[model samples]
Target: MLTDSHTHLYLKNFENDIDIVIQEAKKEGINRFILPNIDETTINKLIDLHKRYKNITYPLIGLHPCSVNKNYPKQIEKLFQKVKNTQFIGIGEIGIDLHWDKTLIEEQKSAFRTQIQWAKKLEIPIVIHCRKAFNEIYTILKEENVKDVGGIFHCFSGTIKEAEKIIDLGFLLGIGGVITFKNSNLSNIIKDIPIEKIVLETDAPYLAPHPMRGHRNEPKYLSIIAKQIASIKSIDIHKIAEITSKNIDNLFFKKNQNII
Candidate 1:
């Protein structure tokens, strides 16, 4: 019943041993993987991977903030059409990131606003990717949803106050490998945020947890994350798994379980 709330299961890193990875994770009690699409280019591969493991893998589609280039209008157009024409559980991996290039802040904001609109119209959660731009993302969300749209702040790295803001917005904080890092104070942050307001993710092929911190991440490693949260919250690992899986199912599967 464990769920990896966010993962890129179809990435190139899993090309050679994708089946092995998924099968091992399945054996480890990782029952479900919520796949977040990078862009239009990766949508087909994401879908192909989902088809192979349809019972466990779910798909979320959106334009990543990092991919918000000069021609994002054209890209968003294609993604918007896909979202409207196709059936996905949610719109995800979307938001503002001023870490890479602050010059494109406005462009990223525009894409975020547009996607938020789509999420509202479709009545689904919007998974956000915020980096060094929490204020901007929060402002946009507040301006858009007075009651707030449910979603995940993927790879969430923020203060307790910021975490509270996300919770108030009816969103969940996506806990990932960064929490397992030696110097990360995320454990302390999570100590305050209730487990109900949190979700699990690997962001695979990117952020790997301890012992495998420098290597490619897989859903099997989700066990380690659950264990970490257990230690942080002074609860059992199974409890962590049960709560996070329940929260994720309530967030995504409850919306459109069959479509994904």
Candidate 2:
């Protein structure tokens, strides 16, 4: 089976026919969908989806870096309450993003650090969302000495050197639709990196792959991503699926596959 390691099935884009979307994905062998939480607002929706599809969907919780603001302390408190109250696969969609605005850079760092601490305390992996702030993120991660709890760098778009650094720091490169872009350098990086250090994701409702590019993305498109990787690495599609799925299982579902 294929796994879309990072997606937001709780988003409104799937509101109209989420069951159909999920069913279609299952039909295509994209059975496991890892749902990453954005903020407090989507917590219930994420949990509800997990409850409804207990065996197929895994839920991750965190305050997305983009949502980090002056009131982040309060937000973090609320998030902690939820983290303590539920069973989550990981802590995620958290990190630094300077593309949209840099005014909240400090706040984002604070939030990221707090969540990293939480992940370490909880003994769970993290799902990172990094964009235009790799250097800053790497600095904090290094300073915090957060090596025990690893995670995926969701929607990775970095140089091979950066990718290597992240792997050394105990994180996997999350490959998604961007790798299939005509001018993308991801294919080259994929060729260089070991498949074991990689993970598949859709970041669905965004970053749709080619042919499906410029359109909405979903878990079903993950097969296309697996195919792309197979071609890039010159490995069989089943091998890609098996190894990547095993990687996800190791990181997120090792102790309790039933929950995912």
Candidate 3:
């Protein structure tokens, strides 16, 4: 069994045939999927998907960094109103994305800090999305004095130094299709980081691995990622599966069980 630590099945990319996509993933041994919310607009879709696939899907609620804008406070209020009564696996896909628009940088930071407080209050983990703003994100995390509830750094493509910093902050590095890219420096960093600090993800409908590069990603493609990690680490695929599976089990599932 493989766990996709992060994915957005609520997106329009899977609108037409989500059932079939999920069935195919199960058939491929990609059983568990952790879905992260993008914004208030996607919450209903996220809840719908979780309700439909309760056995295989886990829902995480949060306002994504890129979605942070001038009306972000209003968006966050909507999110909190929706989530206040429920228990979610995490608060996530939240961080700064300077790669797209820098105008909302401070707004994104404010949103991130607020969400971190929510996560701490709820005693849940967080899934962060950082793009070209690692330094700022790290600074906010530090200022918040974040500890205890570590989270996943989704689609991690940072340098070894950055990886170390995140790990030191009690976060796990999420590895996906990028690690399978021949030119991706992620492969080199993965070689040095402990497998215990890694979690597998597809970031589905995006970041498809080599061989399937350019094709729309799906959770079923996770095996290819596991195989690639095994090759890079010079370990057997089963061992890769075992280690990553255990890491995810601890991070998301928490309860002890034989996932295989």
Alpha-carbon TM-score of each model against the true structure? 0.96, 0.97, 0.95
Question: For candidate 3, lDDT tens digit of each residue in 1-260?
Answer: 88888889989999999999998988988888999899988999999888888877888989999889898888888897867655588898899999978998889999999999988887778999999999999999999877777899999999999999999999899999999898888898999998899999999989999999999999999999999888888988888888888887777667324322
lDDT of 1 by residue, 1-260 (tens): 58888999898889899999988998989988988888888988988888788878888889999888988888988877766545678888899988878998889999999888888888888899999999999999999982445889999889999999988988899999999999999999999888998888888988999989999899999888888999989988888888898888888768566753
Please give the distance, in angstroms, between residue 5's alpha carbon in candidate 3 and its true position after superposition.
0.7
The TM-score obtained by model 3 is 0.95
Looking at model 1, residue 129 earns an lDDT score of: 92
lDDT of each: 0.87, 0.91, 0.88
Ranking by TM-score: 2, 1, 3
Best by lDDT: 2
Whose lDDT is higher: candidate 2's or candidate 3's? Answer: 2
Worst 10 residues of 3 by lDDT: 251-260
Question: What's model 3's overall lDDT?
Answer: 0.88
> Number of clashing residue pairs in every model?
0, 0, 0
lDDT digits (tens) for residues 1-260 of candidate 2:
89989989999999999999999999999988899999888989999999899888888989999888899999988877876667898998899999999999999999999999998888889999999999999999999787888899999999999999999998888999998999898898889999999999999999999989999999999999999999999999999999998899888777675665
Error of 2 at 69 (Å): 1.0
Model 1: how far is 144 from its true place, Å?
0.6
Model 1 / residue 29 / CA error / Å: 0.7
Q: CA shift at 252, candidate 1, in angstroms?
A: 1.1
- Model 2 reaches what TM-score against the true structure? 0.97
Q: Considering every candidate listed, which one attains the maximal TM-score?
A: 2
- Residue pairs in collision within model 2: none
